[model samples]
Target: MRVLEEIAIEDLGVIRTARVPLASGLTVITGETGAGKTMVLTGLGLLMGGKADPGAVRPGAERAVVEGRWDLTRHPQAAHRVDDAGGAVDDDGTVVVLRTVAQGRSRAHLGGRGVPQGVLAEIAADLVTVHGQSEQLRLRTPGKQRTALDRFAGAAHAGLLADHRAAWAERAGLQSEIDDLTARAAERAREAELLRLGLAEVERVDPQPGEDVELGALVARLGNAEQLRQAAQIAHDAVAGEDMETEGSAVHAVEQARRSLEGAAADDPALGEQAKRLAEAGYLLGDVATELSGYVADLQADPAALEAAHTRLAELGALTRSYGSTVDEALQWASDAGLRLLDLDDGGDRVEAMRARVAELDEQVASLAARLTAGRRSAAVRLSEAVTAELSGLAMRGARLEIEVTDSDPGPAGADHVAFLLVPHPGAPARPLGKGASGGELSRVMLAVEVALATASDDEAGSVLPTFVFDEVDAGVGGRAAVEVGRRLASLARSTQVVVVTHLAQVAAFGDTHLVVTKSAVDGDATVTGVRAVDDDERVRELARMLSGQDESETARQHALELLESSAVGR
Candidate 1:
């Protein structure tokens, strides 16, 4: 069994330093109002990584520290989580948890290593369950009610609920995909048609790479054929004489200079070098003249080829206007459009596939939901009978708890809507927990539910129930009802640890271990609260104080002694 071995609180609230030792069975904490009994629970909460408050620190203290040691031999999941957080478990199967609050900031530590506060919270869920007035109110909510029923059904219902949840999620995803495809059907068709038209236009032209640039140069040359021929003729005459006898040409002038230089070559060797250059220049002039003549012969104005080039350019230009600013850009657009068309065309096939999957998931969800409903309905009958019997012992003799599991639309939790209906008397019509039960009655009913759930856990032999802490579970209850609440808590403690913060003497007498929180002025002015386990005479005095207003009253002492005796017999 999971056990909170001990809790130590330092500088927390009015309690300066208190070490509260816990026990495996029922441990009851009681004190006068404002005497700081709740501080015990506050420390436990902090040790469990509950939200920390700097204001909770005692006056003049820098920080508040709360620590707890737990025996986790029976709680492997909690030990595993601690191990995962880098915490070491002792050979005796104990783990120490620490929480410190300072300057409005909180920190948690597992064993000796510092860890995230959330890590402590995660492990705490497997170690303790704190029930207070708020939890009773939560019992009235439909979600909590459904959860309670599912929990009562145990693993069979839980497995089916898990399966249904998976199927529901799959169905939801497939339906969403189908809806998107259907919604965009018209848009996809439009895109496909546009892509097809663009591809066709690009294919019709079939333009080659860089062809437009080459054609531009060729067209310019053909358009200026006559001017080019005239220019070539002038250049030929300047380089060489039109005929061999022509004067004032470069070839005749160079030859005359070459003859004069050769005559002076015998007297000056530099003149011989000049004559050789002139001879080479005349040869180059002859070659140019011949090439210019050949160019003039070949040059012809061909309007047909020019017209064809212009027509091809116009076609490429038309393609560029709609698809791109250039032929290359248009080609790229066509390539991309072809790929996009394939995806758009596949939308229909994708929608059909998703519809088929959605249909398949729908069947799976229905089947699982049906199983979950059947399981819950069957478990509900047992749960109702069990809780009704518990409520009878808690001072509601004829009250019956009716669990109503009705069919509803499939959801993450399955297709059943469960509600806890209470029949307050034998002949009364069963009504919902909120409308049918009084405050005290509701508290008793919640206690009964807890007892039933704990019993269910015991039968399963799965994970053991965590330590239960109830803050004034007997609120609005008195007389024999208070005693019954105590008896129930004591009975629950037989299977697990139960710590109840209470005020009733009848309840306090039933505790196997009793802690009394007392307030006194210390150091002349400072008020301090402290908790200590009381037994025998001290326990009776404490109970006497609870029964009346004075612990020394003979009448109250007698009642306290009788309560202790009766509690012994009851247990």
Candidate 2:
């Protein structure tokens, strides 16, 4: 989709301020050593959220800045991600990404709005793939080989891989559950026994809600029975005396006053009302005396009953001290403990069920892993043939590429170990990629693998091949081999954008758009480099210089022209 359109870099490494243009074809950058060729890649890396190196800032500069423009006309997914990050896309479907490194701090901006560095990284992942010497080294690992194969396995195989991972995860969870249950078996048993003992004790005592409070009242009353009886008798005597005739008694006194008032009632109406009130008061006093006499009689202390109440109170007290602070609280604890004991009782059954499920998942995972292995093996052959075809065009004629998938212990991805093997010729033993290939061969192999993957990606639904950036892809090659490398890169550019930074003139001659990084010294002290697009004449000079370190050499210029003409013809 030609995702990266251009990049503007400032105060980064040996480059001061330069705007490099890009397009949808093979674009190559060439320069003398230390002419800031790496700075261009560094800038692109920063835009892709690579680690910021404060030391890369030019001397006397406060910070280094790199900004990029990306066109999203065909990348609706990336455009949506930009919106989700609170960034905007230009009217022409372009979004600007900026990265700045100052001192030890780095910041990123997208569409003129501040955003997280990770946002840039996430977007870049689907928009660009950068390969350098370090990336070639990383291709040595089996893990990377497997990943490459999986990417070529298409969507159906990817879905199968996902299902396998899900099954493996479920199995791991069930296994964990079984292990935990086994490890804590004794602990759970002890806990259950303690609960049983507590339940038994509670059942024996049979404490009720508020039972202790009631028992406390009964004990206090029974212990003071004699005093209670005496108090009641004195009150009864004061109210009614031994007989009704007792003069000092409240009932008698009230009755005498009522009679005195009644005798004078005929003299005044007010005296009649007072007499009626005194009569009512005398009746009320007599009722109180009768009730007090009943209470005194009922206050007899039964020692056997008092002793039984005390014993019951003591049992309730023990329960309060152990289980709760009160009888009601103790009862609540028993209720909760009963429910917990029910759960503890089912622990063994739970463990058994979990083990059964784990066995079921183990079978499912094994089947899925076997399928995954089969899928990888099937895809490996196709990928090997495709990459070998690519290698043939990259000047590795008769070199056969083989993808080896071997059995391995089941893992999250699958149960296969993938290796990229190279058979130099028909009789040669198939050796691993990094082990047998030279620098140039490895370079071509990496390129071939990328091309194979990119071609496969074109068929997948909704898949847009990202821009390919290769750093020093022609590390060790010359003559016809180098020309083949250039031709191969140019061919790859037909479907997508290809950017390569190299010192080889042969590789650079094939570029649709050629950029040259030129270095100059100011005041014979400060060094600066600038990247600019070159015309045909300038390109010839640049290629001549790269050929023999002399831009004006007639012989070098002739060879440069011949190389460019040959690459053009191949294109």
Candidate 3:
């Protein structure tokens, strides 16, 4: 809606760093070849969320950073973008946006708040629409054509287009389901048999959780039964046998040692401490032996219970081998199986219903396509006539132009296919805009279509046509025709911003805001980096440099002064 407020660059490749302030009128940029004219556009493109290239950074530099700042709170389209992104307007109703590309990443921000590139791009697309000759190459694609038309005719047709797309997606979804179910029919038969056999196998034994642990405990007790019984019998013999005093049984031996130490205590105190320690060990061993003897008396072996435990463990192993790593996992697999089995059983009915629904969606898409085609075809004649009228003022007086709408298969933009066809002179065959139209002709026709489309879309707000940027818009023309080209540009300027990088004084004379792009050596580097607005007298001097490549000549200066004066361009 407005010219860019600021562009800041730092170590952004060869740029090193530069900042520029822009004005809100026709701004002309004139420079020699390779003066970094393209850099300006590239910078704008990067800030608008274009892909970043680390290679764009200067060698040995750590990063490339380009920052663009815009105050767009007053722009309706910009306000809508802010509202959608959950952002608020500033006190001045100005939202400042900054986009940077550095260190192999591109990021954006709004009102100093970080946002994604997608959000910034949405706002940028509305704020600036660049239309250079190279930029126009993007128009050759049919996708671009459809997008522009939908955007130009957005309000009435965008919702219908969305509906068509949703229906198409639904139809695609059902088709995919049918194909998948058809492929799985045979596989399901085999899996169902395996599943049935597996369920029966696990169900017969009904293995419980921790069955293996219980089996392990039983096995240990059974294997140790004999050794444990023998050990308990020997301990019982030592403590309470009939030959109890032979070699002094455990109780009698400890009593003898205690009495001997009591007598020796008068001779040595160390012997007394040793005897006391031996009496404590003898008491603990006697208690454990008595307990073991009772345990041996009650020990019993049951062959049936051991066999049952082993059998349950084997059943659990089978489930673990087939279903999952653990009982919990096995249960989860069973739950999934139940759900899948239900779907497989009822899949036939579901497939049939989806087929019916897909057919209904197909009908809806076809009907919408028919309506769109009808609307486009009906408007073709009028649109062509309007463009033809605007072209006569550009230079060609009797050129023939026609709008062609060919029917096509359903696409995201409906079934209407539109193209602008032209015959440069009478009796010439009509051809598409790019193939037969000359460069100058192409520019004029583009201007005509844009202006007419803007008028037709007057009811819609926030659709500013793209600014026409041309490096050679005035190429190969002079006299009244050159003047006519300026008129055409001025006509376009009424609704769309026009920026022409040209050598023709006639074209430069048409600017509402004239900027001189000069290349100068800064710190011994040959760089084109200066841009400044010029006034009425200054405009004549710059135009003279462009016209005669000299300013000392009175003749060249007079012509330059006339060109500006005749156009009444008081920049």
Candidate 4:
């Protein structure tokens, strides 16, 4: 079974170094006043990621360390989480958790790897449940009472709560959407009008892709048409003169050079190669001269065409200034605005649809909340009967607990509030637990409720926690009542490990394993404490000390022996 195998502490408070071994059944830790019994729980608190106090460190020590070993063979999920955190569980299914407090800071480790203190807290939640005086105080709150009732309502009831929460979340989302649509109606209308006007302007201008750039080039050429024609004429005259025989013309000069090179070709082969190059050059010059003559003739400026182009370019520029840097970008903006306007126009229809959906969800939430309330009320009757039955054996004869489920405003957890009331005797009226119970009565009532829950719950909330630790939960109890407290603890231990730090020998006598915290003086004035298991004879002496201040008294020893025999028979 999953259990806390051992806890080892070093230099914490009065404890120098000690290892407390635990087992499957009831394990009791007992010691004299100021003998460092609380230090044992302090070490466990550190392992559970509880806040570290620098004052808890033993004087002259650098740091205090607490380590715990857990058997996780039956808890694969917890083991998997450790593995995910880069820690390893041993072959025998044991995981080691260590916490160290130095100065004012604390550090935690799982398996062999370092981890956040919160990691230890999360993993340990499923491994142990610690019940102390503080827990009894917390049980008085309304929130804790409701949680306890819901847990006792079982798994099927839990599913109903989940469905209700989901429905509430969905309804909230729809309500938010409807609120937004209503709040921003005027703003959305203004946006739609602006988009419509802009779209109309863009449609009227209707600029084409690359149209502005193309028109710019045409305007430049037409503005300087006369100058361009003059340049073409001069270049044409230079390449192919006024007439073919014109002196110093490019065609005439190349023709003369070709003839001279051909005449010398007969005397030298190099001259023939030069003559072929001159002939190719003459052909290229003739082609250029023809193109230049044609260009001069066709290059005429048209005022009407120039005016039309200027007007179109200005229209495109207006569109660009308002929407984009270019005609194409402006066109893209127009297309997007058209779609946005359509969406704004449909807002009314969408809001109507959403409101209808929200109304439907309201009905669903109300129906589910009703079902949840009914289930809780039914479970309340059974839980009250069960806890009242347990209180009879915990020294509160004729006492009974009554659970009340009342209606509340519907929310994620459903529309119900739960409160636990106590009736001290048959003739007394039932009052809320906090008001009707004394300190001793409250402790027993809390214990009875816990025992009832533990035996009744088959859900993960009850089954996953493998160990329970009680720190003087039997406070203000003695004699017969003390024996019953021990017996109930022993009963709880049968299903899961139970560790009790107590002063009652009646309780200690029922432990399957008994450990006592012993104190000794060191050096001149320093004191150190250790925890050790007691055998049957040592247990008797320890019990005697608990019954009376003197362990050597014959009568106290006899009472201790009798307590052990009676508790054993009860177990």
Candidate 5:
């Protein structure tokens, strides 16, 4: 893996202004505490798409930005991503990835095409992983642990899981059918009572189309019977006659006028037509009077059964609120509930079927779980042995490691319980690493496990694991142990890029390339710091300072030169 170029970062938390150029091989960065050693890590983390830390924005700085230029031509996994996103590859076969973070906006680009944060994280997961000076807690979470174990187990179990789920679904479906049938066994009696009561209510009311409107009008007429009759008689008198026979008749006047018009029409044709129209109108008015007289005579109140029907309908309206939205909907709900009650009373056969299915599933799951447990047991031993070997190289000499497996009840993944145990020194009782190992010890144990698992994965898959970062793994160790750690890390780098942040001169000497991190005042600001890849002499000076506290001392210089020279010979 190679990082070709980078640009300046300004007012980004503690890093006032920093520019860095990366090299193809290992690069070690060393700096004093608060010299913004972590600022460099922060910048790298952002470029690699880690979570944004708003606090990382320099005090009073409006935004924080990190820009990186990585040459990804030879990166096997990165090549596929570039091609997939339809990005252009340069003539020199290099792909450029840029990440930027502002106050409220974060953006990424590949070959100048805008990409979302998720895409950058995906690519960055393959590029780098930051493990602090302590163990990574996220790796030990149950979900991640289960996933890691499954990934270690490989592809054969994928089909098995699918088949098991399908079988479980079939059994579950059958069980649901049985439950439904059984619940219907005793619902007949209730249903009959419900139907009879409902029918009686409906029958008593005998509601018809437009019944409410018609009955309302009838009730109003009956309630005001005498008043309505008197009004109608008055209307009859005005239209034709209420006493045409007993008094001077209005009809007689109309007939007399018609005679006058008939005489006039003999002289004028228009007056003869008018007289004809008047005679026709006289007959129509007499017919209307006969009808009105009969209608008024029959205006009597009905007080008997209208009240009874209305009361029955009121009961139905109340039932409408409790039972269902409407009469039809209520009837349907009752029907379903009735069936469920019946099944509960007499579904013996279906109940037996349900029991049989549960029993069968229990047996099937137990069998599959046992097999899964065995496979995990075998895998745990191999993983533990490899990790133990790696742990010793990380300076935990004479350490005892174990993978303890316990039988758990059936679960979605499997039935074996797994945990890593450790004893730091000879004759010590083995205990879980979280309980037994110190911070540094736990860090080494985690590294061992990560390195081992990464080695066992497919080439494309392995490249994306958390980078095996050795942060001062050589703090308290040297000689053979320190050398071993370096060798193992170098070996890991062959498969996945390894980045180490260290204070140990021995570890810095082992790096294929060296970098020096420094702090300085920029226009009198305390936060200004910078980091850049160091040339041979600068690297020697840096390593010498780390080795002795006296960077300018001749003895420290000779020692640093010898260490670098020896590392080169060994490589």
Candidate 6:
């Protein structure tokens, strides 16, 4: 029972400012062309977050604004969303929505807080559904026709559709996995072979951490062994006297100097200090001589060990060239290859698993699709019967609607191809709505379908539909057909709010509340228009104006009165 309580439009098109009060039943807005009746629908669109046009602003105005107040006690989902967006609902369960268009930009506000325009659009989806001439064009599309049928089918068909969609998604996922695995099978096999060869080589070598570094040092030492031995022998000779020659050796010279200084130590204390230093030098020289002799004895050039070190280093170098620049990097490659090899080995198993899952999903999708087709077939019968009944009252007697559900390849929606066929008269060959119905007939059929869907929704959910706004629903219709369209709208209004913009006197007469848009010059001679509710004799005058060119025509006024009386009786 969501209701639009009020709408305010300012500086939009030809209307400076207008406050339109809405009621619970049928409200028809009527006016002559260029009187700003369409502006009402435009304002409503703005309140619902429709795209704003800068050209819609009045000449001197900087911007345009449209605001609406809604009673949302019955729309808990919308109320919850508002609360989630940090908006407040009034104590009486009402919310304010405003849309402002300025300088090619549009802004939306919920309650008192600014919100994204999409937020208002989301709320509007559950609050109102606007049907205009464009919808008539859409009704001719097969997809739209199918959607209408699903909507009319209510929750049962929706459940089946949901199930079918889930199964289809599962099947699609498995099929994608299978395709990927199959396409890459040969490439993966090659990758696995390379990884296996690398892993085997690394395992055969089995190099330890830092092993390459130790081997490099050993090789350098072995390569320089002969040079090192010669250098050591020269140093030993300089530090200590050679076995056969000791006269000029450093140790003997220091010993003679120490003896000479000891004899003179008694004469001067500085000379005693010098003697002690020379003695320390002699002792250090002796220790160096002993170590030198031992080092020369141990310094045998081992060519075999040197050759082995060189050979081991060459082996490590070969491994580094193929795998990594260093031993650690080569080891890291081996680790990575091992993991990759595992995935490559499991590819066949994964493909088999996907195939099995795909088979399972195929079964589930087929079963769900069958159930969906059955449900649609059942609902199509009820929908056809209901629309047919509605058409009979819309002045199309004996015009039967047939909803044909046929089998098609399974898709996201299901396996049923739903079409609406029209049999214009008894025994008349049934044809698709697009071919069988004229423009006026199609309009009536659309209206009938809406009425049928609304009724079906009410019966299935025990809930009222949203506000239904029909912009010139009686288009291409005249005479009793227009009157019947009005009557149907009036009847739909009994359950929910219905707003219609029309110029037909018969349709306007059936309104529970009638508003007329009038245009005139103001104090400064500027033309402006606004909407106001008209009733009693004023309503009769408005209706008369619609019926004929003159509002004061005696015959037209009489006819308006009779139309009102007849409408009341029909109600």
Among all windows of ten consecutive residues in candidate 4, which has the lowest summed lDDT?
Answer: 457-466
Instruction: Give per-residue CA lDDT, model 1, range 257-321, as digits (tens).
Output: 89999999999999999999998988888788889888988988999988998888898889889
**Cα RMSD for candidates in order:** 8.9, 6.9, 6.8, 5.0, 8.1, 7.9
**Across residues 414-510, which tens digit of lDDT does each residue of candidate 6 receive?**
8878888999999999999878888888888998988887777543433458899988788888999999999999888877899999989889999
The sequence of per-residue lDDT tens digits that candidate 2 reaches over residues 212-242 is 8988998888999999899899999999998
Q: Candidate 2 has what TM-score? A: 0.78
Q: What is the full ranking by lDDT, best candidate first?
A: 2, 4, 1, 6, 3, 5
lDDT of 3 by residue, 1-571 (tens): 3446656665554566566555454556665555555566667777676666767765556766666666664477777777788766677666666666656576777766777877867877766766667645555555565555554453556566777778778788888989998889889777776776666665674656666667778866765777777877887778645344446477667767878897898899999898888788667756766676678887667677777767766777778778887665666677777777777777888989988998898899899787766655655565667678877876878896776678777775678777767789998898877687777677666666665565564443234554445556665566777777776666666665556666677777878777665567767765545556787778788888877877666788899888888777422
All candidates' lDDT scores? 0.86, 0.88, 0.68, 0.87, 0.67, 0.86
Return the TM-score for candidate 1, rounded to 2 decimals: 0.73
Residue 149 lDDT in candidate 3: 52
What TM-score quantifies how close candidate 6 is to the native fold?
0.77
Clashes of 5: 15
Worst lDDT run of 10 residues, candidate 5, spans 459-468
Off by over 4 Å in 1: 83-92, 111-117, 187-344, 457-462, 524-529
**For each candidate, what TM-score against the reference?**
0.73, 0.78, 0.76, 0.81, 0.64, 0.77
Regions more than 4 Å wrong, model 2:
71-95, 109-123, 201-317, 320-339, 457-462
Model 5 alpha-carbon drift over 4 Å, by segment: 1-13, 19-27, 42-129, 133-150, 157-214, 221-364, 392-400, 409-413, 423-429, 435-440, 457-470, 510-514, 550-555, 565-571
Clashes in predicted model 6: 0
Off by over 4 Å in 6: 83-92, 110-120, 201-337, 457-464, 522-529
**lDDT at 85, model 3:** 81
Ranking by TM-score: 4, 2, 6, 3, 1, 5
Per-candidate clashes come to 0, 0, 0, 0, 15, 0
